[model samples]
Target: MSDLPIVGAALSLAQFIEMRDVMFGHDRDLELQDFHNPQTLDSDYTALVEQSKKALDGYGGRHGIHGPFWDLPLATWDPMIREVIHDRMFKALGVCEALGSTHMVVHSPYLEWDHRNIMHYPNAREGIFERFQTTMAPVVKRAEEVGTTLVLENIGDIDPHFRVELAASLGSSALQISVDTGHAHYAHGACGAPPVDYFIKAASDALQHVHLQDADGYADRHWALGEGTIRWQAVFRAIGQLTSNPRLIIEVYGDQSVERSMAFLQNTGLAQ
Candidate 1:
């Protein structure tokens, strides 16, 4: 197998310690999941950040965290709810600043329903964009000051170009695009969206990060590589063509699954 481009794993601090052999000397996404929890962020955030810093000592590869995303939609029209999102995002950026991380992954606000009914509402698309811009204006500014790029990840988004346009419209260096392979595959398989590779191509130079996983197109499986039916070779081919050099992170379940996923990529000469 050809030596693949450097790849990374998305795991917690404990998982990284346990799978150090498989994950060491590679890019990583520390799944600081507690940051997404309002209670944890409100209570034990400093302690958690300190513990993460201590745990990550001696590791040397490009790294980041899965930023706060649960219930934090970017397109809220309600001013009060938008403020809550802004606070949560800033807190997530606080973790980035503390960890010396350069990238933070956030969910795309576009949903499947949005894709289907956007035209019917006429002004809905622009409204979504305007609201998102309002919610993220200050947050993006903070991200710029902290030197962290907010990589917008695909969730239920079916249209690939929507995010590309949104990022381009914002015109901020702090904002870019991210693709979750399984999510794209699901959109293609279940919905009528294009395949995973299409998402990569659409993002093009704006793409900055990726979450690698396998899925059957029916759901967000987050399974180990080769466990599901994603066209990984095609996905990698598209990634190979990108000049952006986005972080390639295996975001699966267990340590064994992470290792197995790595093995599949290695054996196929797609990635290492």
Candidate 2:
């Protein structure tokens, strides 16, 4: 086993509320996500927030939160959309504070379509970079105030360097990188990008959290670790060199897969 602390599992806010007994019965780390509805700065989720805290009562483990990212682009060509993203993220920080979450994962603003256009024009990257910075600065400041770190995760960037630049340029202790194994693997095979280890090595210093899921060379299956083609040994080796280990969470689909995911990792010597 890798001997890394198993940060537990992930669940949508809906799942936690609807399936509390089955989902939160175990004493493991939790990464909660509010992905079901459109949340705004002024919207109230007090009931769900109360239920979330109650579900974890008497449990002892780490906690992290996933901010709303579906159709919410952090870096955008539209200034109005950027404002909306900022509002939603600030609100997400409120949820984090209520739950005592230490880290919140936000989707990176790198899209393959944008990258292609930037490749053709060679100058459009600056605008995208600026938009990302404009979106993240206030969020980072809010995170610092609330004692939560904002972890920017890669989505569709053909190159991982964009994430490095985003985190480095901001230059805040509240901002860090979150490399999703499935997304990086898909980017590698689908975009002819560098291997997954490249991302782990490049983001090692700023890396703080991970979504440990497996996928084929095709889509982001989010399957059990050994059920797909990721090179677990190489991934751990690269991560092993990091000065600080990240919070490892097994993000899989289906309820049965949870046990199977942890079993595969333990069997393959990736987790204990």
Candidate 3:
């Protein structure tokens, strides 16, 4: 038991625990701001800070932060594109520092992703990799300033290996990897796309967190672990083989659904 790692939920301040005593067991919707838009800045970030402060000071367990993942382009590879994502990182850092979250999960800015096929469409993917490097530089710096770690996640079309290299080259401890299992499943000849292991084997060192969910080997949708046609054991074993236990975040959204999911994780011995 001493070797067991803590399992936790990906939450938003809006669903602070006081609202429901049974969140783990029932269907409850959570309101995590769409990160890509970067516009959902917490107007009352100060107040939100006070609240999460009270939450941890008053309540305890494993608590982590999930940054905006949907709207912002963390992998855009553009120099001036900060106009699209800066505020989101600023606000996300607010919650991380406020709650003392273990880590903040963000996405790798991607381009020409369009549904799925990026690498296969050689013409479309050409040169976008350069832009990816262009965009990450500033965001990497911002993450450093906050004294927080940003777990950059894998998405549909970007090469996870290249993203890992970018984070590594930064040489900042604040930069880390966030492997989204479903995204990998989709990218690996699943997700209605062709065969490609977007996350290369050499990229494992950069990982600091994970998104635990699965899908039929043909789509990128986040499905509940066992419900999906994924080989739960293979995924779990692959992750556990990492040098250390990762901060796992459940990305399959559903209010009450989390309860059953949590139970399933335990039963599958994922907590071990």
Candidate 1 structure quality by residue, lDDT tens digits, 105-191:
888999999999999997999998898898888989999999999999999989999988887777899999999999999999999
Candidate 2 residues 7-109, lDDT tens each?
A: 4677775655564554445456668865224643456688878877887676566787888787888777787987888778888888888888888988888
Cα lDDT, model 3, residue 113: 52
Which window of 10 residues has the lowest lDDT sum in candidate 2? Answer: 33-42
Best by lDDT: 1
Q: Rank the candidates by TM-score, best first.
A: 1, 2, 3
lDDT of 3 by residue, 1-272 (tens): 33544455555555555444543323222223322234446454566567656645534444556676656665464446555566666767766666565567777655325435654666544445455445556666776776667777777644556567656766778888877777777766543432222352435656777777766666666666677765566556566567845666666756554556667777877652
Q: Name model 3 segments beyond 4 Å from true.
A: 14-39, 58-62, 75-80, 111-130, 189-202, 218-220
**In model 1, which regions exceed 4 Å deviation?**
1-3, 26-34
Quantify how close model 1 is to the true structure by its C-alpha RMSD in Å.
1.5
**Residue 33 miss distance in model 1 (angstroms):** 3.9
List RMSD in Å for every model shown: 1.5, 2.8, 5.0
True-structure RMSD for candidate 2? 2.8
Steric clash count of candidate 2: 0
Better of 1 and 2 by lDDT: 1
